[model samples]
Target chain A: MNRVKSKYLKGKEKFAIGIDLGGTNIKIALVSKAGAIRNYLKIPTNTQQGKEATITRIKQGIYQIISQSNLETRSISGIGIGAPGPLDFQKGIIHFAPNLPGWEEVPLAEIIKEEFKIAVKVENDANVAAWGEKTFGIAQGVDELVCLTLGTGIGGGLIIGGKIYHGKNNVAGEAGHIVVNKDGPLCNCGNFGCLEAYSSASGIKNRVSRRIKELKISDPSIFYQNNFDQISLVKIFEQAREGNPIVKDIVEEAIEYLGIGITTLVNLLNPEMVVLVGGITNEGDKLLNPVKDIVFHRAMRYHVADLKIVFGKLGEYAGVAGAAALLWDFD
Target chain B: MNRVKSKYLKGKEKFAIGIDLGGTNIKIALVSKAGAIRNYLKIPTNTQQGKEATITRIKQGIYQIISQSNLETRSISGIGIGAPGPLDFQKGIIHFAPNLPGWEEVPLAEIIKEEFKIAVKVENDANVAAWGEKTFGIAQGVDELVCLTLGTGIGGGLIIGGKIYHGKNNVAGEAGHIVVNKDGPLCNCGNFGCLEAYSSASGIKNRVSRRIKELKISDPSIFYQNNFDQISLVKIFEQAREGNPIVKDIVEEAIEYLGIGITTLVNLLNPEMVVLVGGITNEGDKLLNPVKDIVFHRAMRYHVADLKIVFGKLGEYAGVAGAAALLWDFD
Candidate 1:
């Protein structure tokens, strides 16, 4: 273990249990008010077994952390859960979650609060990640910021006036669903030309597949002729780095569509910074430099004059940290 | 002319002076706290004479209103000006208003405040109109509303949480610049495929010219055989109402682009109401019914489920009414 410094809340040594609940696994962390992760553990959700079973495993994981750290439950201010959403944050109910089946209107907050006898808060996972970036990441103190997660599907959250902006109906930050190209492509939401159709991990993979087929027609002796099914976004990035024309074109097209989407967002919201997360940022300047170049060139001057296009710094810990930040809002 | 009720400040008999400064004329109105206009007047701006001359005209107008209404300056809460923008709202400086010559970085607010010894606020004309709709029109109690003015150019204002959302630099609501078609048409802002390029009054007129030329090739005896220059937006609307296929196609094309642009806004902002302003809306359901149908059909269901698309009720009074509403912000 690394020699960790104490970041407990002063005067009363307070802490929060941050739960990043997902389909495959549940990550529970003991996070101090100062944003230090004192103890952490992960447990398989096994959600297929049932919601109650997964809840039991989560509770056990929480108790395990408390016992290992020799801390009293009284010292923990609250438990914050950042879960997949389409949720009712006001009522602390999970209306529906695609990843976790049978999560229809489950009062997750109430269940946890009843079991642990501690205050609990539930929020959208993407929103928590945005708040996490603001609280303990590179975007600290940025009152107006946009955060995007580029994974299987693109999810986004807006931070306005230093808080998550849930629209009139709690569905405000659906940036992925905003149409970029009116006739470009169809999205899962049955909309034509959504930003997600060209920018998500799946979107990128589909591009790779289509580009390879087009290349094979032009040149019969192209690379990855037989192992096309194994061609991943990582392999595409590696191939682009190694100077493959087909992969380069694919990456450029995706980034161009992403740039157009971001330009629309800049025109509309005029956010101070746009923070990116997920595995795509591992490409570093390869992704950020081109996106910045295109977005700046396309967006209006005043809106982009002081804009910062950066990556989220907290890594995997962002979700848990943001969840814990919910306690601050509760206070 | 009409018997008006007092909407003055509850504790004090106070009113506000609202000036709608335009390229050709300046419309000034004395308005009570409840958004009732007690006195109004319009004067030629003669902007070509210079910024100082225009300032003098505006000052004289203010004095004339005070004298005509038999109201003392002390009873006026503030002077609010709604002018063409790219402005510095914080310092009340007009950065570069193209409509008004030699008006770069002119400190209008400071000069007005010094002369009147009263508070003064300067805002984008479109923003003021939106505020006016909220204060005195159909959207009086609607907090989240989007107001659009479709004239020679399209201007938009967003009321988020019941306040004007000034982006990081107070230039947030440039909705006209939002790209609807990435490769469609050129905008004055040097961008390709802007909403303004396809939906503005000039845009509509240009569509008529292009469509007329295209129709001449297919059919010679079209409506405007020789007098194309006299083909105004009103004429196009009138012709379309008469069931002219060429004119109808032109109007439908413009409305289609407008609908696409508005659909993007609905998906992004999820506002409760959208208020339409300007002459195009004078066509009533001819313009609105089709737009509403297209927009609702294209936009996400949740965003438009309970949405109300209506025309601004205050009509010409919106500018001055919105300007007066600026005083409420100061309070």
Candidate 2:
């Protein structure tokens, strides 16, 4: 949120426009080469307005940030976008995104480039978040790392050899789909016992809701008038801490499964660190400590020797900042 | 098994000694720069005689292989040993292998180097197998791959960017320990529901033995006159195919869990290929077809788009050849 320029950006100033295109909102920021945000703007995606309107909204968000900074598009290094994936990063096309409906093979980069006459790079949200963490956040200078976005659904970004590891088909880091309990609940992806099925915000809430009904708990005050969907994970975690029966078991299991999934990743990849980000991280140490304990205890002795499991430092700015960071080289 | 030297191994022939130090035996080979085994030797390890005796045995095997090839130790490029892990590749120390009891932090590389005055590298067996597949076996030319050794126990070796990825602690490719059926069975590793507990040779045989007793099937010929340990996995698979009740469910579940484990790997790493090796691979297409079907159908569409799940080409030579392969560069 700081507009203060870094003293290290002493020479001819460089800036890049970062766009975090989400299902609910479009976040745009004018970021310096040093990862400082000079101008920021947020606007509703209104996907109900259709793809063209959403694109227009993104353009407006970009234009709004640029105008706020009083900088010409030509002066910027480039525009980088972090969008929901199944993306063709090489071609700058989004093949399909789970969150965004009616978005199929959208040439986001080309459309944005045509409007601004600047080079554009589109990356997966998870990958961008990872890049953001690697470039400027907690995992900075971490060569081998896995950054997880723990929100409505879990997403993973793998940094192998200090670069985003895009698998053969550009959808490599799908950590959420990792089967923790093969006999566990079904995931949104139709896979049974995925990490997302156990630990994601939706997964936790789904179970909590089911358990609440099963136990016939009619406590409205405990659930904030039962508007559970609008409720924060922090509240649920607090309830678990306070010994609410339904929330406690469900939350403990979710955290345990999260730890198991992370343990699986650590065993397989043997990363130097794991950065946890997104909404669920709002629980902070309550989430990280337990997950860390599980991973540290369960993973092989050698793997956890120097493995650091912690939270992402960039917070909400990771997406926009990381998307923008894709344009600059990390020294 | 072919003693035929590659015609291209011309001019100045370079060789490296590969030692596969197993619990029961020490297999050593003189391998050429082109990944051809010029000479091979295998002798009993006799761990009961102590670690020093086993080391002497390894040395004898190496000497025999060198004598068979008529090559001086000085002429060898280097020696690479692929042994049961928790190995320190940098220091060439075996950090207490599970199979080879009493082999605790033995500096095998230093001991051998002092004796032979040649560079020595010690790597985890799984990693060597993976490197072997990538360098000279079925996964040759594949940059991203996961090589699985399904023998007495399941082991995984990952080849990322055409090199063995020794996670943070040189124990990264512990794919056998990946919890597939989290609620399934207890693993020898003290973990529950590991891939090894479900699909490894010992795992399958143990379940078969227990099931045979439980089912009260007194068919002596079906299990080779109650000598289950001496039986091959091919026999069990055949019995399963023949619709033998006790063997059928256990065998199917074993294959299914193996498929699930492979599917987990495919989903997590998004590797280009998966190579299956070791004793259990004797079932060949019977195993490969079912695994391929499961992975292709279960894993993400993009991941399975061009994924190749196949068997290792080096057969039993994979361990020795792969260990030797660690000494050379594949161009």
Candidate 3:
């Protein structure tokens, strides 16, 4: 095997392991400080097998990735895991993640450390993605940045002065639940008019379903036939792009709320850059341009002038990369 | 004079001059690092007298305060001036201040530094007050804090990681202008439903005046009629405290909007503490309790549990203390 040496690698060539634990899959990867993925592996989460079984799968995934690498596991710095929240980062516990069955105050970091005999850190998945973006993606070299992940639920992570700002109780960056329209819609968090209630994929679906019901359109029962399984965001986007008026209106409404949320973040953080990530961001400039335009128009001109809103470059690897970076820094 | 040695005064006690440049008056003081005010002087700010005359009066005010202090001029570290914005902190220029007539892009910091032969820093008055509160008042020992000052207009400052978080253009924290009520009221900034449009003293007066007009009450103007030389916040607070129905309703309405503003800050920064300062806070527990109740009730519960809300304790000396601390740390 040929060993590559470069200035960016430094002397020891530090490396770390990152695990992105999602509802459907568990992805593990070994990453370098330069954001290069050396070896990666993925496995079905099998969350239905319960927490203990799922934890075992996660360990196996890590081992599988490391075994494929030429570098010794000893040289691997530490391990970082990104899981859904609400989590207690200080305690390294997953408080209660709706997506992950039977996850309640799971001591994830300690469990992984005990199994592997290495330092382990855990953070909310969105925060980890933000960290990944800041260190390796669009926000590289920027001091203050905010990353918003638009998926089933809206998630946000704030980086201030190059460090993750986990507010008191590790819930500081819950931008999704921030009320944009106090009288708009009922949110899962029992709040009215939260950005998540309008901006999330599920939020969009709910809005569309409501509008469809009101218009007495032949029940698009196919949309919810498989418990929303057959309904994909891409399908909606495709329809909207093809001039489906109903889909167009729903997407436009979501964009309006997204703009409000973006403006709020701009006014509040005044960050150098705002990086948008997750499944919804795949819509590209179609969604980004309107959101940017409205945010700039609504926010104070002084704060908005230098603001840069861009799509996250790291894609699905963001979590694993960010987790690896965390290990590299702490270990 | 006997100078008692104390732990707080570890080195040769340094002093700094602070200038609060208001529309009506220029208040200058000699301040110690431990939040002590050695001497103070106030002078009329004759803006129509032109920039030169105003600068001359400011210099006189500084000299008068310094002369009254036991400290020598050579021992003074520097000077910190708090002025109205929009300002360029990096260039030390004030773009325009509505309160300060004819103040446009004035290089106040450079002018003062040149005259005194000492380093000078100029910041937005609200930001200075925030630093003042964080360094010596209610937010002492808290690393992440935000201070809100309510007057004719609402002003804000953000203290993140123990340093003021000035955004890309030095306009990071304009919390008052964050739109809470999207369809509520028109703000002077040309925005609809800004927190400043609802919470400021002038905002309260406007809301009360509108109600009186809508009700067609005879002698509606009597409520705001000049009792003596001024219409002060103290007068309004007294009327509300003494059970004036109209004034009480207006104050409650303002407090409701202020609560929303505070909740927005909590949601955004997840600050460890939020301190309320300015003339309006003189309502004490009456005003603070309602705001606290609303913020706690409305914000993410987990994030709000550790959040502390308190009234500023430094009173009028906050600017002087903050300025002194700024210079003392100048090295």
The DockQ figures for the candidates are 0.62, 0.64, 0.51
Q: RMSD for each model, in Å, please?
A: 4.3, 3.7, 4.1
What docking tier does model 2 reach?
A: medium
Question: Which one wins by lDDT: 1 or 3?
Answer: 1
Docking quality tier of candidate 1? medium
A1-331: candidate 1 lDDT, tens digit per residue:
1123233423566688899998878999998778888899988889899888888898898888776655667667888999885787777898778788887889999998988888899998888889889988988889998898776677788887777877676667777776777786677667777787778777777777776676565542343435644546777777777878777766776777778778888887889999998777888898888889878987888889899999999998988899988988532
Candidate 2 deviant stretches above 4 angstroms = A1-13, A72-74, A209-239, A242-247, B1-10, B209-235
Worst 10-residue stretch by lDDT in candidate 2 chain A? A1-10
Model 3 over residues A1-331: C-alpha lDDT tens digits?
A: 2134433345557888999999999989989877899888888998899998999999888777766665555667889999997788776899888789899889999998888788889998988999998888888888788899898999899888778887766777887876776567887776677888888998887777777788888856534535544566666777777878878877776887788777777776788898999899888999999999888877887778789999999998999999888875531
Q: Write the per-residue lDDT of candidate 3 for residues B1-331, one digit (tens) a residue.
A: 2234433245666678988887777878888777778787777898889877998898888777766665455567889988887798777899888887778889998998887788788888888888888777888788788888877788888888788888767877888787776677788776677788888977776777677678886854446546533445666666777888867877776887788778767876788988888878878888889999888877876778789999888888777677666665531
Q: Please give fnat for model 2.
A: 0.64
Better of 2 and 3 by TM-score: 2
Question: How high a TM-score does candidate 2 get?
Answer: 0.91
> A3-83, model 2: which lDDT tens digit per residue?
444442456778898888898888899988788888888889888888899998898888888767766666788999999
- lDDT leader: 2
- Across all candidates, what is each one's fraction of true contacts kept? 0.51, 0.64, 0.51
**Candidate 3 — which pairs collide?**
none
